[model samples]
Target: MGIGNWELGIGNWELGIGNFFLVFLVFLVFLVFPIPPFPHTPYRGSS
Candidate 1:
């Protein structure tokens, strides 16, 4: 491996896997927030 393991494992590595988790969390939030075609549009129920 180069300096550390070339692949990521669940153990404590020199390059923190927390960074990976932080990015993944941000990505998940991004996916969840922008799904609606019109996010600001209010609900018009049962017309």
Candidate 2:
């Protein structure tokens, strides 16, 4: 089935914000408080 016209009217920013909150909720559920990981981490590989 195709998407409904009402849903399509919400547009990209609305979708993006919705997704952002959804992700935050999931993170809070799993981790309690979301502390983002450090950007720089050395890659570990077996020689």
Best by TM-score: 2
Return the clash pairs for model 1, or none.
Answer: none
What are the per-residue Cα lDDT tens digits for candidate 1 across 1-47?
A: 22233255335555456556665675576456754665542222321
Question: Could you estimate the TM-score for every candidate?
Answer: 0.39, 0.42
Model 2: colliding residue pairs: none
RMSD (CA, Å), candidate 2 to true, equals: 11.4
lDDT of each: 0.48, 0.47
Candidate 2 per-residue C-alpha lDDT over 1-47 given as tens digits, one digit per residue, 9 for 90 to 100: 01342254357767656666665675465455433563332221221
What CA RMSD would candidate 1 show? 12.2
